[model samples]
Target: MDEDYDYFQELRDFLGGTFHQDISSPEQALDEYINEANKECLLFTIRYCDEFLTSNRTKQEKENYIQTNAEIYFPAIGLTPLIWLNNVVEQIKEAVKLK
Candidate 1:
């Protein structure tokens, strides 16, 4: 976890520059899906989740919100969701395999 490694940018560069010819479309699709997910989150989902922290809302209100809209707060609905989630798991597996 070198702070300067710029993992996301380097990964994007490697995908866009090194393997551009082979995986450009798939990468773009994935990138677009990520962007759409970001939009979905910031506009609707985050505010909904943030309401849980509201001092104005009672505990019952928080419970109602969670009961009604928990799924939207789960994030990363498709494509790379699991891949994004288990990044540590994937890295650990790779490290073990390389050992």
Candidate 2:
């Protein structure tokens, strides 16, 4: 979907929150902070990607599903599930580089 929101700004905003109680809350620290519960939720959302690709639903229906699910699970991100998933992937990539 074509969205106008600033991607980096969302990351910045999330990192600014007090979600993590340990470690410095740097963007690079995202991977470390995503505990098991968050990981399970993210994985659950990600598993829908294949369904989104192959389903016979109309484009709008698929988009709506993604938005609804994202809002339910990750309202703080204020982004569609796919977008949030992409952001998570980017965070992982960055973390991997530090290893």
Candidate 3:
């Protein structure tokens, strides 16, 4: 949680400096700060999940856990954030391609 908070703070400072004087509203500010964080988190989560899937030991157990968690809990808690984070990821990817 502390690491997450620090990443967001650093993002806010970086983007705020870049978009200085144009960013408006708390929601906009948060969106700016969290967009990069969301991208990193999405990449990290997918990579970690893939690593867990590939691990020789307990691969089946990890698969069962992810399957059950997705079926039972992720629907209720995951869709919105996943969608929003995905959108942020696309934006970041596009930005990278342009540069």
Best by TM-score: 2
* Residue-by-residue lDDT tens digits, candidate 1, 1-99: 233444334333423442233443434434443444444322332232233243376666544433342222224344332233233224333333433
- Number of the predicted model whose lDDT against the real structure is largest: 2
Q: Each model's C-alpha lDDT?
A: 0.36, 0.44, 0.42
RMSD of candidate 1 to the true fold?
Answer: 14.5
User: Which scores greater on TM-score, model 2 or model 3?
Assistant: 2
The 10 consecutive residues of candidate 2 with the worst lDDT sum are: 11-20
lDDT of 2 by residue, 21-66 (tens): 3534333354444432354433432334343435587766655654
What C-alpha RMSD separates each model from the true structure?
A: 14.5, 12.1, 11.5
lDDT per residue, candidate 3, 1-99, as tens digits? Answer: 233443323333443453344555423643564455555554443344334435564645543443333222334434443343344445555544443
| Candidate 3 local Cα displacement, residue 5, angstroms | 16
TM-score of each: 0.25, 0.33, 0.30
In terms of lDDT, the poorest run of 10 residues in model 1 is 40-49
Q: TM-score-based ranking, best first? A: 2, 3, 1
Ranking by lDDT: 2, 3, 1
